[model samples]
Target: MGRILLPALTLICLIAARYLADQVGINGLPAPVGEWIDPLRLSEAAIWLCMAWVAKRAIEVALRRGRNGSDEERIPSIAFDFLGVLLFLVAIIAIAGLVFDQPVSGLLATSGILTGVVAFAVRDLIADIFTGIALAIERPIRIGDWIQFDEGTPQRTGRVVEMNWRAVRMVTVQGRTIVFPNNALSRRDFVNLSLPERHFRTVKRIVVDFSVPAERAADIIMSAIRATPGVVPSQKPLVLIDELVERGTVFSFHFWVPDYPKMFMIERQVVENVLHFLDQAGYAPSYPKLEADIAWQSVSEIDASFDLPDLLHRVPLFSKLSEEERLNLAHQSKEVQARAGQALVAEGDAGESLFVVLAGLAAVHKSVEGKLCRIGQVEPGQVFGEMSFLTGEPRSATVIAEIDSVFVEVERGAMQAIVRENPEIIDQMGEIQASRMNAQEIGDSTDGTRELDDPGFAEKLVKRIRLTFGQPG
Candidate 1:
């Protein structure tokens, strides 16, 4: 397609350019020595520039395809640039010879000193061009390579988007563009995160009270890392005891991720989970340094202090679980607080975490007659969003906090781990869900209300929940 289309456009531009030149009476055959400058040539140069661009694009597309068939298409883009330049010079010479009866080569020979002066003026630009060529040949970093440099301080990191004749363009993780001169990169040492695999391990160091057992802290980190969705399972997360600082014991947790762009997001999840786990496991960081660490954390990652295991015990489904099991659930749980009228889970919004009300009350509301009507009150120890969270379905009703509320949010990840450890809970969970659905306190007369007690319906719902949450039989 490119072969047929671009060349035809180039031909059209060539024709139009000649017709315009003829209309303006292109003559006055100025010799190279006679006209040190020619204003008339501006019209001709513009047309040739258009031709070169189109011709370069077409050649690039065609040659890339042709090369891919028989050989490794590692052909550098500079080759295409050279090819287009050669064609442009040929075209300019032919046009100049026809108009002024002197070729560009002859004109250049007469203007040797002028050409050398121009070359010296653009020496920096020429150096960049040559450096870019060498970089393309060396192939240290190709397009799409994630790299980090300026190791001294205020590091620059980004993915290489493109390499032009003079500079390398990179788009940073913080959504900023950085164009570095080729000579700059040629002299500096950069860490290519793309080599071998995109997966790279990042370390997060935390200082905890010295009283806390290192083994326990390491276990908590390992659990969080393994349960994290974006973490690469092939690379096991590691924990190292670096040193005991003035504050507390320093522990470094290393995690591997394949996608560099989502580093912050995945790290946020892991860090938040680690904090929760630490809090639940009766482990606390040294307050002086911990305060600073907490302040640096994103709003979404921060949580008010709460006893996660105790909250999990309040949930009827997890109430019967053993102390160890409850603690594990707590490690995987998120503590969420809601003010009055704040929706815990909204109708038609997809959910994975079951909100177990820990304090205050929430009103269960659903659309009735095109208006949200209060159905029932969810008090302490009661659960909402179980159906949607368990089944990976949209919330059937909106549960808004009637007053200030605290909730023990149990996500699918925690549920999966729970299932993996205790397979027998699947049946119990299904029965509890069915019983809750059939209870009359919730005023909805919809499918979730009426049909849940049906044995087949319960079985199907349980199966779906199991599958969606990655619960193995």
Candidate 2:
């Protein structure tokens, strides 16, 4: 609306001027005014130019409306700019022929010669302008698209921000603005990360020791990628053995990221989480080594790979427990393996134990409006089901294994003695459970901070835990 205001006002003023010109005859006007007005036909030329501007604005507005005002479907700005220039040129020629009553054929021929000379002098600029027009029409890459312009070492990736007559401007992932000449851009091969869909598949390769079974490694890596936040979970991410080299076995991980601009952030998170999961499972990435005997885990790290106590140490709920208490809990706990799609716990079911994910992934879901909607994911080292275990309430949410998963289940039987010895541990457990409950109730907070501790809720939770375990009031 703001864009059309100037042109609309100009058109109104031109119409008024034409009306006044006719009412007050040029012959009755002063000598110089009448003399200049008749030859120049100033009023008529002004009216023609104003009409052209108004028409251009109207056409642009109609194009936008045709797309239902969707930013993704709106015509590129370069298209409108080119259309305006073309319309103004046509209006200029109309003024020469009709308003001035002059033969425009000769004028057009002279303009053609002048244009040829200018085109020859600035051929590169003309080429860029024409190439930009072609790109605007073809739309191989649109504004807001992520593209790779140079695919050499240290590849160049940027989001298209603006396209004008001679150049395309993009802001890189590093926040640097880069301008590429349209003709140059058209000549090179480029990749549009956003085309087909904003979600695109990417792969990462990691080397694991040959000592680790390829099937186990593949399962672990697939679960790690699937558990990541930005990954498209419904697509079922895959992992395959790519090669066997001197270092070890190369495994390829394939997953779809929901957006291109977020690719880097997601990649960082995937790597960090994947490595952590592998470490929890007692594996490490193998480096190029010539030695025939390659140890997968060092002597110090071997216990961490297999010991239940080591896994217990990583759980946040057990953070307050002493080393001896954790070992005692570990002695009584049992390891359970669940296949993909298996229900670990069902909503409203009886459960007296909490489970900690040791490998693979699981999803937390609850019945919302008669539909089971997924609420969260469980990754390696994370604990779940404590509310039902501590309070003996019906399971508030159902948890299902997303992939072949391993969990260490600690029943109330295992924890009874530990809590009885140190009642203070109940306070810490209450604090942790209260934070989890707050997170679920609050959803994700925009401020990037969660309610870390809720004393009132914690106090109530402690009582529930004591009652559930038959501890003293």
Q: State the C-alpha lDDT per candidate.
A: 0.70, 0.79
**Stretches of candidate 1 exceeding 4 Å from the true structure:** 3-59, 66-79, 90-111, 152-155, 288-473
State the lDDT of candidate 2 residue by residue for 335-365, as single tens digits. 7889999989888788888888777888888
Off by over 4 Å in 2: 28-40, 152-155, 288-290, 294-336, 344-358, 363-378, 381-399, 407-473
Q: Estimate the TM-score of every prediction.
A: 0.51, 0.72
Clashes of each: 0, 0
Q: Judge candidate 1 at residue 393 and give its lDDT.
A: 73
lDDT of 1: 0.70
| Candidate 2 minimal-lDDT segment of 10 residues | 441-450
In the range 329-437, model 1's lDDT, one tens digit per residue, is 8787776877767887778888777876554456788888889987776555557777666777778888887655566788877777777877767777776666666
At residue 110, candidate 2 shows an lDDT of 76
Worst ten-residue run, lDDT, model 1? 292-301
Choose the strongest candidate by lDDT. 2
